[model samples]
Target: MSDQYLVRIEGKNTDIAVEETQSILDAALRANEWLPHSCTQGTCGTCKLKVLRGEVDHRQTPEYTLTVEERAEGLALGCMATPRSDLTVEPLGNVSDDGVPRHPLRDYEGTVVVLDDIAANTRRLVIELDTPMQFNAGQYAELIVPEHAGARQYSMANPPTETRRLEFHIKLTAGGLSTDGWIFRSMTLGERVSLRGPLGQFNLVAKQDEPAILIGGGTGLAPLKSIVQHALVEDLVPELFLYHGGRRREDLYDVEFFRDLEHRHPHFHYRPVLSEEQWEGATGLVTDVVVSDFPSCKGMSAFLCGPPAMVDAAVKALKRRRMAPRLIFREEFAITPATSTAPAVL
Candidate 1:
């Protein structure tokens, strides 16, 4: 194997390791340095950085996402660009220095140990890692699929306490490459796989008694479930409202679990909204349910995961309720095009 190159951030004294196989964003994330990004893919362009000096391979990014003129101007999309050699890059913004020290980035070999159906089109995949990969409650991992040239990033539905064991909610979207091509139809037990991650910054804060409102759509419930479970175990959050939405009754599969949680915790509230179905509990989009329930969202923290549109809608609703912009955390399942140059909402 070849040696990884050193990447120096243009404006900061920080230096990060970059492998030719990994995107710059992923490398920076592994270093636990917060870089501005939405979806860790080329679609959003939130992670676009200026290549002050160095050679880069921007071919990983979709042609449409970055223009030739931009490339000529020494611009690169951090989520898609891989370092061709030693480089100096500039971040679009800065991150808080008050965060916890990040876990070291490491590669782990794993095999498929468990696969079970969770919802209408979702499956729970559990992989036993070769070594423990410590991650925050709401972070994600990019699994190295056997066939695809690019890996797909999925949020870990389990917390750090369950070290060495990674669980991901795999949603089968229409025309998805890995989900349909291999994972669902051909992947078998004991099949060897590789993963690198514990990526992203959407996580729980140390607010012991604050209300935690979580909104999820489709398969986006994975990380939120992890957060809720961690909070419950630590007895951190006193009040919680989890609003999950789907088209039909089958979309929201964890109602019983939330109901059970509500039974045990007086402050915990479960609101599963169905868009197409006329459910008696809550109807319409999950954002609508969130808005209707809390007309004024002051002094509350909200975590949202789902398609870009749903997450945006939830942010708008929460802001309307007077929820502080800083308190609203989000992880987007960016919808990719038919080419799937980027990973879709998972």
Candidate 2:
């Protein structure tokens, strides 16, 4: 029996070799075959596909995300399923050309230049890469956890122009393998780490005319920061509004950075909202504040990144305010189970 199996995509002239140890999605992306995916972990069901003709070992696929009935009905998560034999699969989501630039996946090694606590429970990590990585503004990279045999996904906070250095805002999770066990506790500056590049499809659309509203919660601000910087540099939008939400003032970081941008750019606006503590700026939920500011979002496009609850609420609020469904893009920060030693999404 061959250790590697050939997997063919339905209706596409694409066939890739998948090692028995590799996930189907990993191999597809390495072959430059774009597929819809968010968190590369098994948490998000975004990578769900139909296994048309072969067997797959659905390893580590969460039951909550991929139900037993779905598996029995020929459904599998491309991020978690490993080929048991030669396969034929069809991605559920459309992978048509949308004019967004897709950077090929590659491995890179980097030294940790800076690591500091930026917020209450979040830390700012900067890595100087050995080779430059080309990525879309909102795409993410996966860092291999030393000695853990797993990797955690973190969005680059810097713009794509800074290809030689990668910036990440990571929120520490209690007892997390990559967080508590490593980044927050044992990791040090000048240390080296391995990482993979330019993952995820949540990115800025090309040639968009409408003003953009970016909302972020906790460390979810990482990718939005990249987007805002890129947009301002390229003048991608007529106006840009950034709202970072936190439970208290201590939870918010980069206040001065955004304030400076707002001061310099007449079209840029920055709002920091505190939910648990009363602040001089906006209060209550971030989504509520946005709703109050924009009576109608009919002519605006929005990018939301945050916890699932917050993202879901923002989507609902924007939709009620008349924002078109297609104009709203979101990325939910999916935290892994505390007990499980699996790689998590930040």
Instruction: Give the winner by TM-score.
Output: 2
**What are the lDDT scores of the predictions, listed in order?**
0.79, 0.90
Model 2: CA > 4 A from native: 338-346
lDDT of 2 at 342: 40
**TM-score, per-candidate, Cα-based:** 0.88, 0.95
Error of 2 at 15 (Å): 1.5
Runs of candidate 1 with Cα error greater than 4 angstroms are: 1-5, 11-22, 29-38, 63-73, 208-210, 337-346
For model 2, how many clashes? 0
Model 1 per-residue lDDT tens digits across residues 1-346 = 5458789987668888887766787777767666776567677677888999889987557767778998999888887788899999987645546454466556678989998888888888999998888988888887776756556779988866998889888889666677887678778889888877766767874545568899988889989888888887777787888888899988777678889988987877888889999967788888887887887899898999988899999999899989999889889887564224542111
Clashes of each: 2, 0
